[model samples]
Target: MSNIPPAGMSAAEWQTRQELAACYRLAWHFRFTDLIYTHITARVPGEDGHFLINPYGLSWDEITASSLVKIDVDGNKVADSDYSVNPAGFTIHSAIHRTSHDAAWIMHTHTRAGVAVSSLEAGLLPLNQIALQFHGRIAYHDYEGIALDLGERERIVASLGDKPVLVLRNHGLLTTGATAASMFNTMFYMERACEIQVATLSMGQPLRKVPADVADHVATQYQSSMGEEDDVLLEWAAHLRLLEKIAPDYRD
Candidate 1:
């Protein structure tokens, strides 16, 4: 792959590609990736209905800024590239992006703990502080086998509604944000929450739930903290610095 930016691409689109690439590297750092499967997509700035996604065969760690593929909402390539997009995975992502304006960035993961929690009947429990952020704000979409069917698109949109997170029953986890930083932040905390839940359940003891009112209060506090600024920007910058130390080529 070439490190040079594609010719004629707008600076804004190039920057979005870089950020989306950083998100993939960060996901790998957090161990939220499942081999070459799953996807992280971001809306190309200034380009309506166009988005950036990883090339089909690359693992999260292998994805680079210039290697990302630009695709329209229909999963068709909007720009030339040597790589192809995964239509099956793009089904879920395209559906959400087309249906919701707030879904500027979407992330899906098949981590062990995320899938484990999705299999549970109760879904995500409000058993800890991190989990509380999702209280009453998360949506659950039932599994309907592999998501290759285009018909499942409407249902995926309906299941997601106006929520930021979706727990794919018997499947895995999905999160979205208006920016890549916010979406990455959501996935990081959510994946950690799932890991904690799984570890807690393994002790085979009853788990204490945070009171409903308190959980709601905490969730409210988190929402209020966002106000006008993207609260995750600073943290995302820190992540970029860390990535520079470990995998600087992702920015290529």
Candidate 2:
């Protein structure tokens, strides 16, 4: 599609599209994506019940700011675009965004490590600092085949509750935040935690659990360290710079 920003679009909405596009590109760069499978969606600024998601069939790296399709909570396109949205994939995201005011951005992935950890009977063990960040803030939703059925939306939302991270049992991982950067930040760590857990477990050696109290304390410490300035924004800025050096076309 056209790279130029659409006429009459607010500066805020345009920025949101760019940030979401950058998130997709970054996921591709970091190998967080599974071909064109997973989806990342951002709520349209100042627009209630609307979101921006990658067009169906586009590889994450092939996605651009202008290529993102705007759709309502029902997964119906709200804006004109050559590409169509993935209704099945949007079901998970739409369910969360519909129920949670804080879920301004939603990220889902099917990474190998994430899926491996999801299949475990004891999900996301507190094996390290990265995993500890989700000590009491993670939820698990049992897999129910593909997410094409709209009836599964309520169950997914119920399973997620108010947690920022959700480990789709035997499926993959999902993360939500009030900002695209924040969501991306959570996914980055969550994926790393899964990767570490899988690697550690593969050794078949006894694993040491970071004590519950310590995990709680560390989670609180991490939250305290995030002051007025948003860590995600800072991290996203650095990532954009890296993308500029490599794949700047995502901004198109």
Candidate 3:
């Protein structure tokens, strides 16, 4: 549990670090990784303006509880780490953490299908059930080149506007949750939604659009289903169990 030097924080942060690390490994096993480029970050418990992210130089699978880096909103390391942090990653994440009060964990990805649907003008259309889950719940930010510039953060925050999912046009997908597990759940389904949208659109058939009312119901169903105790506990426990079977050392 003590992969990095003691930062004088509580045990809650260590637990968050372990979960964030496992999320990285799960992302790797599930093919959500983009080499060492994308990130999944969690806010440090009891600390404002601070969050945990993967060490920049390591692949997702190589990340562990102790190897995660803690950095302030200013992109400065708050703890002693042998690895550097990525400026671009913080540029995107800090904007949300700085503004949205509920975004305890933020997951960003550049998956092939995710980028594919993001490139579409319709942007995750209600073409299928999976895609419908995000009807009216997805937010869009026009392409603004690489996200390294600090000025773009404000516009990004404006576009997010309290939505759970943000689709960066011509880029990729991002999800926010009050917990790491909820955040992972959003990305897992969001990526699937994108994949379904791309596949259905590629078929080039006349779309059988879901009725607007039905889409609304489905979307609301998804929203209402969130934060349920049994569902959250079971799904996250299963994911942890699977990770334990294959990559148990993430807890290090």
TM-score of 2: 0.95
- Candidate 2 residue pairs that clash: none
- TM-score (C-alpha, index-matched) for candidate 3: 0.94
TM-score, one value per model: 0.95, 0.95, 0.94
Prediction 3 global C-alpha lDDT: 0.89
TM-score quality measure for candidate 1: 0.95
Model 3, span 144-171: residue lDDT tens: 8999999999999999998989999999
How much lDDT does candidate 2 score? 0.89
Q: 231, model 1: CA deviation in Å?
A: 3.7
lDDT of each: 0.89, 0.89, 0.89
Q: 1-252, model 1: which lDDT tens digit per residue?
A: 233566887778878888898999999988999888999999887788988889989989999988999899898898889998888789999998887889999999999999999999999999998888888889999999999999999999999999989999999999999988889988999999999999999999988999888988988887787423445888888998999899988888
Error of 2 at 143 (Å): 1.0
User: What is the C-alpha lDDT profile of model 2 across 1-252, one tens digit per residue?
Assistant: 123566888778888898899999999999999888879999898899998999999999899898999999998899899988777788999998888999999999999999999999999999998888788889999999989989999999999999999999999999998887788889999999999999999999998999888999988977778422466688878988998998888877
Q: How many backbone clashes does candidate 2 have?
A: 0
Q: What's every prediction's RMSD, in angstroms?
A: 2.2, 2.2, 2.1
Off by over 4 Å in 2: 1-4, 226-229
Worst 10 residues of 2 by lDDT: 223-232
